[model samples]
Target chain A: MEITPTRVNFEFNPHVPIIMDSGIFKAIKSGGSSREQAIKSMYEDNKFRTQLSKYIAQNQGNEEDTKDIFQEALIILDKNLRNGKVDEDQNINAYLFKTCKLLWLNSLRKNNKIQLIDFEENPEELVTNEDLETFREEGKYKSLQKALTKLNDRCREILVLWSQSYSMKEIMKKLDLKSEAMARKSKHQCLLKLMQIIKSDPNGWED
Target chain B: MNESFYTELLEIKAQGKLNPEQEALLTSLIPQGSDLSSELKAYHLAKQAIEIDISNELKFKFNEWDQKKKSRLFRVDFKTISIAASLFLFLSVCSILWHSNQHFSNRRIVNDHLHKFNTEIRGVNSGPETLSDRIGKLRDGLEQNPTLVIQETQALLKLSVTGVQKDAIEWTLALAYLENNQNEKALTLLKSINANPDHSYQKHSKAVLDKLNSNWRVFLF
Candidate 1:
């Protein structure tokens, strides 16, 4: 039978059975496995992309951080689905709730939280805790964006377009740089100095 | 504030790659002298203002979310769940909270439903005399052929003696209690209805609960 929301009474409270069945024991104990399989399949569903995208787009945060958080949540979901951490009689909604909460707490706690998630490493995964901090700083690139304006008009135009994905050749042609290589390296030094000024007031630019 | 330190950070930060040791150095080296401290404070204030600006946008999204959740009566579908998760994370990324206004309403719904229950039940007089009289009848009834289903039905309707059986006979009695605005009795029977786990009227019970939670407004309507 298809389970419905009204069946959320594994106990009266939502948090109860989560504590009771957290993956260590009762998941695939004896006969019940199909339910577990169905739950695992449902857990990794990417169908919610629209809602996730809308929420991220609407928020003030950098899209990259939004991506980080969503990615971690997905990773957690995949790991849990692979493990016997689920039961057919279990509440998938509650499991999602707890999983999301823990992932969020991990996001808050720096890289330390990664170890807490009991999982085998995915080989292609390059986004680590360090990468999260990097994304965080990248999100604060706005500080540098603001600081670049402190430079003269030519510097501002050159830097803004560069930040916006203009290539070195494009910037050289556009800004009338001495040469392509000069534009590339000088633009680098200019941006570096500009970022220095921004980072000088470190309290404000925290990612 | 030297160019080299900034360049180091810019390179790694631009790559969006930093080990803990490097990040530690960057964070620790942020000067705290009087001039620098004051500048940092101003920047913090400016950042707060920027956050407020962004918060307005987040609130719009939150309200949209609230409306969607209200319409959704079934399971927390993948869409809704993901939106909630992403929104929560995005707000965190923004360093701002998008608290659901539902906290007050969620609590209020729970309280008012419980309150309506209390008011309707009015409890056969909260006195020992009434209690003893009811106890005596209940004891004698127990001695009789245990009308297990009937008792369960009565308890479910009363919203007391929860986990009662849901037989048709019991339901008739429960319907009677509901018609009479004997909400306490109805609630007890409803609790009994919970035992089936797969009862047909489970949705009906939830709808009734939502209606009841609305401050006795159902009766007025």
Candidate 2:
């Protein structure tokens, strides 16, 4: 089998715009410490957290609410960025704030909590309806992930490496498989087993 | 295609290693609304779920960081803080200017390539409304009505298509995505085309990708 060598680069240039759907973003997709570093920077950035805390507070939320909403916003942002839903030039801070606002509003509406303040912001400025729809779709993945945890350790390891773009040769070496073909077959079986597990659960994939 | 062939294709796809020809073959072989297609969708969902799993791990790490940060004590001198603030301001200004220039240049380069692609499509669009002609029209319609073009191209992909026809349609669809400012989708399609040695649009796709990568490298370094 002719295996293309995987490109491995450890250098993370802090100057590159991490929001751009290229370059560093591609590095993040390929998965490594760079992705972790980028997420850490976003998490630790006080400006975004401070702005969101103030917004949530003004809208009748407490400190715990601010932290929870902020964390959810970060997840949404990270998912959108990975899925290419975010545009290159879009303001990340504004996007996160808008997502938090929308999520909080949905939560309040669900709880039948009386509105403390009028959120008269332009609807267009909020995250797109498509983004909300995508977020809904993501809820299914959480269930699927529950199914994933049921897989045996070796199967889980194989599937994770495959998803991370590891080459068959590397997987073969790491797993002590006889050949690349065996590695490929192992990944295929693991995926099929995961699918079977998901299918077996009556409530596994319920939307 | 036979059952084994379909299974092989699905396996390759599950590995995320399907070349363009194999992708087209799988599309042609799988019956619409069949169990096979659902299985393929399951595989896709599983892959996405794994990615979400990875992100969740990161979220766990973030929680750890939050706890650790809360527990840590910080002490800073005013002079040190002042010097750091000054340096940050200077670097921020420089970074803003550099990023603006890079963004502008990258946009210009992308526009130039799209213009070239438009011309090429027009040259191929003279015939009647076959698969290629429909793709050509979709490319032409991208500027005037991108949403319609995107819808039409997506619908077109559902129909059974030959390998070369699939390549033409996908290339045009990628361009339409670019026109619609969906860079991620466009990049995915372009990379697929460039990876497949037998893909009809391989050369053009490579050229565009090369330009894009060069610009990214310039921005990175």
Highest TM-score scorer: 2
Q: Determine which window of 10 residues in candidate 2 chain A has minimal summed lDDT.
A: A5-14
- Alpha-carbon local distance difference test for all models: 0.44, 0.67
Lowest lDDT block of 10, candidate 1 chain B: B97-106
Candidate number with greatest DockQ: 2
For each candidate, the DockQ is 0.03, 0.18
Question: What tens digits encode model 2's per-residue C-alpha lDDT throughout A87-143?
Answer: 756655556667877777776655656443434556666485456533254456567
lDDT of 2 by residue, B117-137 (tens): 556655654553466567766
For candidate 2, the docking band is incorrect
lDDT (10s digit) by residue, model 1, range A118-162: 343445432233322211354354554455445566655555444
Task: Report, to 2 decimal places, the DockQ of model 1.
Answer: 0.03
Best model number under lDDT: 2
